[model samples]
Target: TLFVPEGIDDPEIEPGYVERAFATASRMTPFWTEKSRQAHDIQVRSGTFAVTMDGAPIFGPLPGVPGLFVNIGYDGHGVMCSIEGARRLADLMAGDAEHDPKDPFAAERFLDGSNPIPEPMTIHQVQ
Candidate 1:
């Protein structure tokens, strides 16, 4: 679900948004095509704020924090990139030949203070 700000919470009933969306839809140039596949029955929540240094995802063993594993910080690309990311991370943990080096996604990079591009990574907007 898209998290609308407090003022725009009820977009259906909200005056300005209702008119704007109606006008935009009437233009007949939708941004994305409608999906035709059967829906995968699952519950999902959208408020995930995992930050990493390179803005790329971190998907491997939790460094220095032993016994804890993590496959996180895909930013907004988690749904699209998760399949490969999970495979690579699993390979790393299993010490398999297919495991790519985890240097690019090291959690330590966060400590080095390199900021992700297109900054202010939080999805929450400040008024």
Candidate 2:
């Protein structure tokens, strides 16, 4: 989802506060562009970044929760990793895989005050 914030000024966006985050994000950057003046999405603050704890996503049927499943905390690569997440979930449900991939994203890692994830460029190289 797009997840734009309040004070967005794009002509497509009405002049008001964006209360629903998911809806706003849905309308954000339908595609990429190099020019800000031509952008339809509004910028809240520049040079901002998101932090996800160091972990893989929590995918597949959750442990000890009968029939319950989850696919969350995908970090910034959700778009790139969604297929993997779906495959993993499917495998677990179909009895093809033995366990969740890792511990960092186990849904319980954030319980004990771990460091927040850093921004994309700061965390890893793209090319």
Candidate 3:
């Protein structure tokens, strides 16, 4: 997926984005063929991106709100981390695992002023 790094405040889709997307999709894609699909063809989808303050995904419960859990703040790793995140959250809910508040992905880390969670490598590729 291509990341543009912009807020949703402006709801308009730019023509440049469409062009770039079409260009990227047409490059060496096995499923795309001359008879099946055109290189310039593209469909616009509505969606938004979410990112936490420290650029790490948040997992576990919402502090001070018992029984109300959350598995959000994925930013862009939802596709990659969905299964594991779901499993971990489920384990916590089922009492099979424990939640470490100091962990980078912990949902309670945002509320802890004394402890700051470092940004995980998911935010950038190590070059």
Each candidate: how many clashes?
A: 0, 4, 0
lDDT of 3 at 77: 78
Predictions ranked by lDDT, top down?
Answer: 3, 1, 2
Compute the lDDT of residue 22 as modeled in candidate 3.
48
RMSD of each: 8.4, 10.2, 6.6
Sliding window of 10 residues with minimal summed lDDT for model 2: 30-39
lDDT of 3 at 124: 35
- Cα misplacement distance, residue 16 of candidate 2 (Å): 15
lDDT of 2 by residue, 1-127 (tens): 2587743543344335343443465468633223433546665432323335563566655666778878876656677887888887788778887664355455555556766565445355434
In model 1, what lDDT does residue 29 have?
51
Give all TM-scores, in the order shown: 0.53, 0.45, 0.66
For model 2, the local distance difference test gives 0.57
User: Model 1 over residues 1-127: C-alpha lDDT tens digits?
Assistant: 4566643433234335434544566567543122212224433223435645445787776757776657887767688877888887777778783423436665655665656464355343435
Of the candidates shown, which would achieve the greatest lDDT relative to the real structure?
Answer: 3
TM accuracy, model 1: 0.53
After superposing candidate 3, which stretches have Cα over 4 Å from the reference? 1-10, 22-37, 113-127
Q: What is the lDDT of residue 120 in candidate 1?
A: 57
